[model samples]
Target: MANGFEAAMRMMRSRDPQRAEDGFGLLRDRAAEYLPALIEEFENEQADRGLRSWLLELIGLAESAEALPVLAAQLNSQDEMLRDWAVAGLTRLDTREARTALWRARANGTIA
Candidate 1:
């Protein structure tokens, strides 16, 4: 689909920090509207490593329980940064699933 979402996605991936910031803001402002697409982008195998944590932060900012699984999955990522953002996301979500994942991560010694 050639929706403006693709354009926003490009901006979010821009080399220019400001463009990426603006795009992230757009996604955050419309988190409910853009979450499904954002989640799809998050799952893209070719997704940039630099932006993966950023996207995770934005998803955390969305504070949607539907994001619990995605955030929880990141808790097990080798990237400690992703684990931190996932913790923040799970905290924001505060759902049972999110909480359980947080506990599991802590128990597994991933997060202190």
Candidate 2:
């Protein structure tokens, strides 16, 4: 993870709404640089559902190609909102693999 990212993660994880909100903005601003760190956080199973969802949203906003795999994986998630965020990220990426995954997910019942 890059410098300041850990702090941003802490802010994102903060229970206080204000801190979390600010952290989300910071994550969006550093979306590209924070891609790997955010992906790592998303991969952690210890997070509650809400935090996982927030991380997904952050990754989508980052719009990094590296996140395609992660977003594609989320297409199969049972959580509809998670799937939506994955689709959103894939669309933002607009790469061949990401677009193909989006199409496949849409056709295969992953994306609604």
Candidate 3:
């Protein structure tokens, strides 16, 4: 079962949007145990734009406060797209910290 879940996560990182969305949906439904692993995979996959974006969307759907630090880290990403997505994800959270981070990123020119 664990291996199957891992495999599903790997599929979620696929280039195909449908596959990614399906896998992410599964994980999102059963995310209690997989959250840590998903966060690690998403953070490590910074080079894959599609995967990263999908991961961010997953994180947004998860709406776990645990994702705050990971999303915050991306605020410093050299990739403008990643930074923008991070800000957007944080805004989706709508927490005070998330809002503050978004404001700071915008002020610092990391987001626009």
The 10-residue segment of model 2 with minimum total lDDT is 45-54
Candidate 3 lDDT trough over 10 residues, lowest sum: 54-63
Error (Å) of candidate 1 at residue 87 is 0.4
- Per-model TM values vs. the true structure: 0.89, 0.91, 0.76
Tens digits of per-residue lDDT for model 1 on 2-94?
A: 476778778988899999988777677777667777787888835588788877887888888778889989888998888898999899888
In candidate 3, what are the lDDT values of residues 27-111, reduced to their tens digit?
7666546667767778677567777776766665566678788788889987676677677778878899988888897889877
Top-scoring candidate (lDDT)? 2
TM-score order of candidates, top first: 2, 1, 3
Worst ten-residue run, lDDT, model 1? 45-54
Model 2 per-residue lDDT tens digits across residues 1-112: 5658888878878899899888888788778887888889999845478778889988988877889889999999988889988888888889999989988988987677
Runs of candidate 3 exceeding 4 Å displacement: 13-17, 28-33
Candidate with the greatest TM-score versus the true structure: 2
Candidate 3: lDDT of 18? 87
lDDT of candidate 3?
A: 0.75
Candidate 3 to truth, TM: 0.76
Q: Output the lDDT of residue 4, model 3.
A: 68
Error of 3 at 65 (Å): 1.6
